[model samples]
Target: MRKLFSIIGLFVSCLLAAQEEEWRVIPSVREWLEEINNWPDSVYRQDNLHVFFDYEKDTGLIATTFEETDSLPSEPLFIVNKPVRVSGLNFAGDRKGPGTMPRRLTSIQFNGWLTISRMAQNRAGFVGCVFKDDMSMWDIQSRNVLQFVDCDFEKSLHLYGPQENMGFYIANTSIKEDLIITSGNTDAGIRILNSDLSQFFVNGKFTQFRMDSTNVRYGMRLSNVTISNSFQLQNTSLPALELIGTDFPELHTYIPFHNIENALALDLPIGWDRDQDLVKYKAESKEEIMDTQRFDNLIASYYTLLEVYKSRGELTSYNACYIEMRDKVTARSKLLYNQDPSFTNFFAYQINRFTRAFSDYGTRPEKAIIVFFQVVLAFSIFYFFFPSSWNTTNNRTMMRRLSYLGSYFTSKEGLSDLFEKEAKEDYKDYEEFHQFISSSEKRLPIYFQWLSKPLYRVSVSRFNLSRRLLASGDILKGEWDQLPKAKQVRTSILIGLYLVIYLIYVLIIRCLNAITLSLNAFSTLGFGEIPTRGLARYVTIIQGFVGWFLLSIFLVSLIGQILN
Candidate 1:
């Protein structure tokens, strides 16, 4: 780009050299404007304007080349109607000398705007200068381009009427305002390259609106940049607005415009942007940082950025903006109470942001996954600590024993009589068996009866073992009075069955299966086919209830997103 400019400079130098030289110098800015009003086909240099401002008597003053006073005026207002070049001047305030504090500049106050009316064959430009209020080329009566480069404006500018044939070029300038061009029923091609604009509003109709390599403070607000003709925007940034190209939606202003970023760019005092005037910002250096609203202004600008991301369908960037806003809000909220955010904002409005993060403020449905895992872990711990009563099989055995005792108590006879009758039957059976055995042994072979004794013992022992396997109570091989009863054993019914085969550490029965069980429980899908007896079954039931509630919250968040 510099090379292109250099080539253009060479051509202009050659063309001027070919023509007759009418080169001249002016004593003051008043004389310069006078020269422009008279002759429109002359060339001027930026050094002449600097030389005029260096005259200390009129250090911070201005004129329209109409007044001839060398005294204080209401404000600085200048008219450029011919070819002019100027740079580095402040028509107001006590500013430092040249390069005293570089990059810091004093401003020229335009109480309202700059007036321009140029003829053909002449163009005007101001570089590295300051204009406070606005710049308007609304009265150019000839074919000439008015360019502003490396300059600063406290407010916006405007151009209309015959702007196409003599288009304007604004490069490397900073505007602390929105640029508005009334291009309706015109063929002007407005080109703004490599500059920062707070905003842009192209009203009416136009043939072309082109902006490139520029950073727009806030995004643009326009239904369209042109009226059935041309509008183009590329390589530009709407840092605050996030509008790209010409895709500006029809915007409605709930509040008026504030070039907050430009204020920050100039490092002006807090609330300096409230008024669209060029004024040097000043405050005591010892002021508390909390009292300054530059941080708050930054947050407001970031919110504008957030809206831009939202409209652009950039969720990642949107989330970034939200995080920054959250932090900034925390900082600003602390200023409301005290400077110590850690101590003062414990229960303030800023704390709401934490709650929002935990639940994602109903914006993220996926956080339910975290809740699901949390609940599963919680219930697993509960079940681990509290053993279930239903798993004990001893209760069933105790109930059976109680029922037997009840039946015996309800008998017609007393306990002694019952025992006597059973004993007499047993004695009669023994005597009959003895007599029969004696007869049979005498009648049959003695060797056969002797050989069957071991077999009879084996059969009796096997029968006792079989009864123990099927019975819910202890097995007795002999009469109850003849032997001491074995102690009953306590055991888990269904739980013991699966555990002995499938579980070792007692948690989830199998390590890998824990995740499956947790997920199923969280989803409220209790597929009972998996033998979940005793404490495991109890935990599953509890998980079902909790899972239902968690899922309901997740669904609510999802439906909100869809509706929104």
Candidate 2:
């Protein structure tokens, strides 16, 4: 069964990778403009195209150049006619859905290059239009010299350039492939983004570029561009890149912009990135570390004592009575009282039962036995899977990598040291350092915490083991009387098995806690609660259980075969 799942997982991953399309390649500025001039506007889907370009008519559209004068206010010379249809694609400038009519729409094909220059006003120039939908793949590649001049995209948009260098301005246009800008003249450049006006996107590649300041919400690149005299400026919004041709070693001064507000090409300090407009993340530091530790310890200790009492049959009557009362009452809370209160939250009361039971189970040998069996099952599985910690850690690392950072500690001792230091540092510095470390480490705070968790958990296991051994009359007799070798060997094996099972159970419970916390953390990252917690979390838990179960079976089978 586990092998079947492994195969299915691999197949699905392969399918997704195969389905993703490659981004288009944009053309140089000069080539792009000329291609636009040759565009078959004659292929207009409606009369709207002519209305925007016909100078003879006093229509709100139609302008000679990129200048907003008394006759022409908007720049970037050419504007696409609304409600244009291309290659079986429908584009409407006016987003009309019942009462909601959008401002305007622009359309471009990604098959050639486009270029724009000599504006009527605004020395920088501009070329853009409100788009109801994304620009198609054919509009992005037909130009070489493309410039925003001075334009803003309104709505969620996409750029699809040509498969090859066709040369054309793909502004207010979507490129199918890479967003390449090969321009010699200094001017405002292309800003391909969503019509919603939230971000700037260069789906594939970025080659040979210059900029004063830009907020590429996702990321940016500049390949084969000379940057000594032409400085690339970056605002505090997005990441910037200086792409030196792979062949030119000297040009590969790939210095990431340290200043969030300034990506100007220059030597800056290491701490400059700290000043950027990153969402002020202030993690509420816990002031009472020992107190928190004591609380957890006390709860765990109480649960362990209860387990011992149950094992000895001392609490059998009390347990029975409590169970009876619980079944009669709120199903778990036989003893519930509130100071100066008459009523309690029914839902909270129910939840508390499971929470307490879960807590109690976590501290018992039964939990370890369950977890050990699970690990054995996982080891039995026919297909390969990562270690349990791998999934959570990998997810965290990926997010951190996207944010451009690395981890400071990847080990239990290292993590413990980090927390100790963090607990003592200034609040602001600690938070920044935490974010930075998480980003750098490519792991979440939860994962780092897990790495150190085993150290503390081992203490519980060891203490319990000692107590269990001391309580067992026969085990103590074996040790004291120097009993037969076979008996001692059997006893040792039992003890080892006991230890394994208990460890597995504890680990699984810890994993569950991590699931809950990580879900809450993801909400802060703008992901929907449904995606982060519902289906995804359940799937993860199921996978973990199945993998562990299969591995255990496999290991047991292998051992049996060897013994036979």
Candidate 3:
């Protein structure tokens, strides 16, 4: 009984196989020529004598042989009026007999819908074809070039597993849906020009891959692809591009973006905080850990793009890519820190953050300068309000004397001979000669008097106050101190004016010294003595260290820029 069942099953399988092969029977070149000749005038014309095949009625297959036929047109053209599906189309050169050479089809044109599950190939060219349905060509092996021109694919087009030495050329075509090519080794490479595509993807190894003057609307991804010679994109606009484990030997010089209108979108594979989330999810659900290979590939892609931009001298794009790369590195470090909580990972994460914040990973030296100035300005403001004892001069005695004179004037016994004697002693060394010498040494040129006159006058008047006060010796004598109230008041007013001027001068000098201190600490120049004491000394030391680090980074970045 079992033997009988087996025989019946074998018979059924053979019948099914035969039935499937019956529809795929393709007409010979001679038969196709006869069909073309028999078509009516309305269906065929002399100028375009291509054969039209209806999918519902006509067998949509054309098989070529090893024998050269004289009747075949130089450029054969076929039109499919409706959607057609074929299990396999053997357009490849087929051997007819021993020692017979394989025949080649140079060019062919298809006008309408056509679908093929598998294709065996020689040289095949497609022109002006419009595929209305999804087309899948699996494991295509072509001896020569496969070309497509001025074609439109309304649905997805999949080309899979092309063999060695097969060249694919596509120009002036539009693919409205996804176009996917996967797992091929083509030494002659693939060239796509002046085309618009949606969701294009390629995963293969090739000698070269180039896309010029093309626009990809949705997204394009190249995963596990290796191009040994070159990979180039010229005047191409890829709105979203994801590259995963792709190797391009000539990435530095070949990817040009001179004419692209939109900014290239480098879509990263994983989020910055993806690892943190993964950690949490694993703790709760105990699912498999996420592989960090994607992150590694993401970093490599960023580096490749960075080199491309740098080689092209696109500074803005280069810096942007550099910053992005550093950000990814920092994030990866953070993930490692989260995983192990080690000091090394923590330090690395923090260091990356610092570099990104200060210099954009050392790609922009100007950023370091800007941050340096910000630090100096901040410290300057702090030192301005709370000046250290070393940078500030002790003016308490001068202030006290000013206070004493004001009080003496307010008191009924206005002033005393003792006070007058002390004042004389203090002003005795003041010289008119020294005043002129100092003013001359510090004076601005006469031509700049228009801009500096006000400041110059203020300085000169402040310096000469001592000489003017002692111009008459009687001003500070005993009789003068015992003068009437009106006279005493006049003398007090003159002294008050001098006190105000001197105080203003001292404050101005103090402000300048504070700025000097700040600059010295921030730049670590140390041109002169650092007189800071106590806490201010420590603060200055810290600023010096920071300055050293930041300046070193600035120099490195600047040198890199120059070298680049």
The candidate that wins on TM-score is: 3
Top candidate (lDDT): 3
Cα lDDT listed for each candidate: 0.49, 0.34, 0.61
> Which stretch of 10 consecutive residues in model 3 shows the poorest summed lDDT?
277-286
Give the clashing pairs for model 3. Answer: none
RMSD of each predicted structure: 19.5, 35.3, 13.2
Q: 333-352, model 2: which lDDT tens digit per residue?
A: 22333212225645546444
TM-score of each: 0.38, 0.24, 0.58
Candidate 2 off by > 4 Å = 1-53, 58-60, 68-83, 88-128, 137-141, 147-152, 163-197, 203-206, 216-233, 239-256, 260-564
* Global fold similarity of model 2 (TM-score): 0.24
Better of 1 and 3 by lDDT: 3
Supply every candidate's count of residue pairs whose N, Cα or C atoms clash at under 3 angstroms.
4, 116, 0
* Cα lDDT for residue 313, candidate 1: 60
Candidate 3, residue 356: lDDT: 85
In TM-score terms, candidate 3 sits at 0.58
Tell me the tens digit of each residue's lDDT in model 3 across 52-169: 2322222222222313232434333554343444445554222332222233332233333444544555555555555666666665655566666666777667777775577778
lDDT of 2: 0.34
